[model samples]
Target chain A: MAKMTLEELRKLREEKQEALEKRSIEGKDCRIIIGMGTCGIAAGAKETLSTFLSVLDEEKIKHVAITQTGCMGLCYVEPTVEVILPDMPPVIYGKVDADVARKIVKEHILGKRLVTDHMFDRPAADIIKQDGGR
Target chain B: MHIAITDYVLEVVQNAFEANSTETRVVLQETAEAFAVTVTDNGKGMSEEVMKRVLDPFSTEEGKHPHRKVGLGLSFLNQATELAGGELTLRSEVGVGTTVRFTFDPASIDTPPLGDVVSTFMTLLAHPKAGSLVIERKTETDGYALDRKELIGVLGDLEMSGNLHLLKEYIASQEAALS
Candidate 1:
């Protein structure tokens, strides 16, 4: 692709802005947060993050917000991902490579089902049994 | 140490966000032998005392992290810069802002390559405070500049997935021209 000049960016904005307006005005119902800390970077979080963007776009999923955050102190499981969907407790999935990221979007976000195998932040995920998470 | 020079840059820009910057500019310039990155932020600058220990991994702004105490990003980058015989300069004023510029010698074996800078730029803009950031990237022959506010103005909000994806393509395309 040729370099996108400001004029092209403006044109893209005009084209995409309409599609965006058709989206829910109530705001995003789902959020995908990627850890971009140093540890996360060393662990290939870049690929993980790019995967989420491409997957979400390919799936034509809207009303979803994708963001980057500092480490959640899960360096041991770098490349951590946190997904927050309405009506479900926020879930943090660790050691998420591109494959796991795809699953998180397909199975967790779109499927409305948690990918239990890679789930961390269990206390929050297991809210029904939360005894103050002690 | 970090695998790429861009990795250190991501961390540095994040630190600027934490500093409460309203405007941050990241300039990446590459040459035959060396590549330099200068990140300047109009945020709450550092004190002399803090600046001295900023690279000490053990030191970080208090109350920044409730449970964590160590910040190894810069410390690790320092190691890489030292091994590569690169130049690192950090200047700040308490109420003004901070400017961190570092040049890595690609000729040195210890120096890491400039990897995935386009993604790094996108990631930096993914931060909530990204609207305050701008990236100016240049190689010896070609270059481009991206302003976060301009992107958000056109694409809507960066927080949304659609906008983020669009921004990435726009960035990647610009970087491609520099090659």
Candidate 2:
């Protein structure tokens, strides 16, 4: 049996309302996706995602939807992250740790500049070929 | 809600969070005879009637989940512990808070594994709503605790996940040293 008091319900409602307001704002077209599959988890992807969340919160950065996904078949670079900005190509970055994640948010997302060093360089055709080959 | 492993301790932790408690504390202990866990939260506690039905897998207050009929967290935990020759206890005061304690016979064949505790703590600590979490694990010889407040003071609010790799290593070393 599970039970919640009226007060608890009210608290939950407030939390949900705050979350909705945080998410449903206008002009929030930037999306950050962190790979959290088994390989990614083993490689510390969760920590990378956490770094992004804290940094965004500390900076009061809004309108960015943060989420997690499964493996991208790039096991060599386990902690992969994809950033999609409105009207820009989706950028995938590999080997993203806490420090690198901060740079992604600061330089790429906010500064409107890509961090070229950590960018995933494999061509789409090559990735497709590898997948099809598998 | 759908846990692949039967360790049910994670659900207890989640419930403490759902209680909208201002503070939450978790303690895990392992001894020669049994393994024990207790979660305490400074949230709105349940009524006597409600607490009595807490294990009634189907018993839940109205307006919790509009889509689901049963509230199974506590109920399932009760069943799991009992099957493992264990006991689950809850103590609460309406305006104060709630505390749940569960113990399992370590030697029992039906006992469930503790599961991936580092992941559990990481997930819980990552939630923005989780104001503060105190997790302490102990065996006979030694124990270590991670307090969010102390961590923030030391690490400058780097985010739980940001520091999780180091945290995992610290926990592993502490456990290893617990001989």
Find the candidate with the highest TM-score and give its number: 1
Please give each candidate's TM-score.
Answer: 0.65, 0.59
Quality of candidate 2 docking, DockQ: 0.05
- For DockQ, the strongest prediction is 1
Candidate 1 — which residues are off by over 4 angstroms? A17-134
**What total of clashing residue pairs does each candidate reach?**
0, 2
Q: How does each model score on lDDT? A: 0.83, 0.74
Number of the top-ranking candidate, with lDDT as the measure: 1
Q: Model 2: share of native contacts present? A: 0.00
What interface RMSD do all candidates show, one decimal each? 1.5, 16.8
Give per-residue CA lDDT, model 1, range A1-134, as digits (tens): 78787779878877876455433335776777789999999999999988887787898887787778888788999899888777777778999999999999889888899999998774344553443321
For candidate 1, give the lDDT of residue B77: 81
- Model 1: number of clashes? 0
